[model samples]
Target: MAVRAGLPRITARVHLDLLQSEDGRRTAAELTRRLKVSPASVSVAVNYLVRHGYVRRERDPQQRRDVYVIDDEAWYRSVVLSARQTLETARAALASAEGAGPDDLVGQRMARTGAFLERISLDLLESADRWRMLLK
Candidate 1:
């Protein structure tokens, strides 16, 4: 339900399927079988999550299977990475706004947004570190 709330139907289903499994890991076939989803659907969803660093993939040599594991730090990594990405985006915004005329509305909006994101990025990093320290 939580997954469904945050993700599209297929991706949520895949995440839930693996999360509900016994060991927090499953082969793509296993996920497909469990969710009764098409292989391509699983592949797409798994790839998306993996690309976002939410899922960790490994290969089983003997079984020749691709196992997808739910990363314990999935949330942390996702948040931190997004924050860092926002930082980069903000930098770009600031650069683009550099030569704009003083009355440029777009430039003004960009500047404000960039400054906000910059602050948010720093706050997010600080909070993430604090959370990590608390967890330890």
Candidate 2:
């Protein structure tokens, strides 16, 4: 999925699995074992996330290993920003139809579509807030 999305393949797996896991944190070795991928692959994904400000590296107090943690702000910003972009695109589509005939079927459909997109965009934002509360 990550590769298809133009991101490193192991990135989606490691990050999703780690965040879904009980502790929501994992060492490189743990990710390697759980993902059944090479250490290099895990390292590549972790390094990318670290550089992108999406993940943080923390030294394990008891073990001589680094644990990757998801950056809440970064994740939130990514999702919200994506939703914003989608909303903007929908708005643009509506703007393009501004001069269309009022009785045109396509214009009416576009208006409905824009309303739906706006509603879904707001819903996504609300859902993000709810998930953050759950994490807290």
TM-score against native, each model: 0.83, 0.59
Which pairs clash inside model 2? none
Q: Give the residue spans of candidate 1 off by over 4 A.
A: 1-6, 101-106, 133-136
lDDT string for model 1 (1-136, tens) is: 7554577689888887777878889998888898998999999999988998879999999998899999877888888998999999988888766667447988888888888889999899889978975433
Clashes of each: 0, 0
lDDT of the structure predicted as candidate 2:
0.80
lDDT of 2 by residue, 1-136 (tens): 6578877668988878777878678889889999999999999999988876678899988987899987667677677877888788778757655646557888777777777887888898888877875544
lDDT of each: 0.85, 0.80
Model 1 weakest 10-residue run by lDDT:
127-136
In model 1, the Cα lDDT at residue 18 comes to: 77
For model 2, where is the 10-residue window of minimal lDDT?
A: 93-102
Q: For model 1, which pairs clash?
A: none
Residue 44, candidate 2: Cα error in Å is 4.6
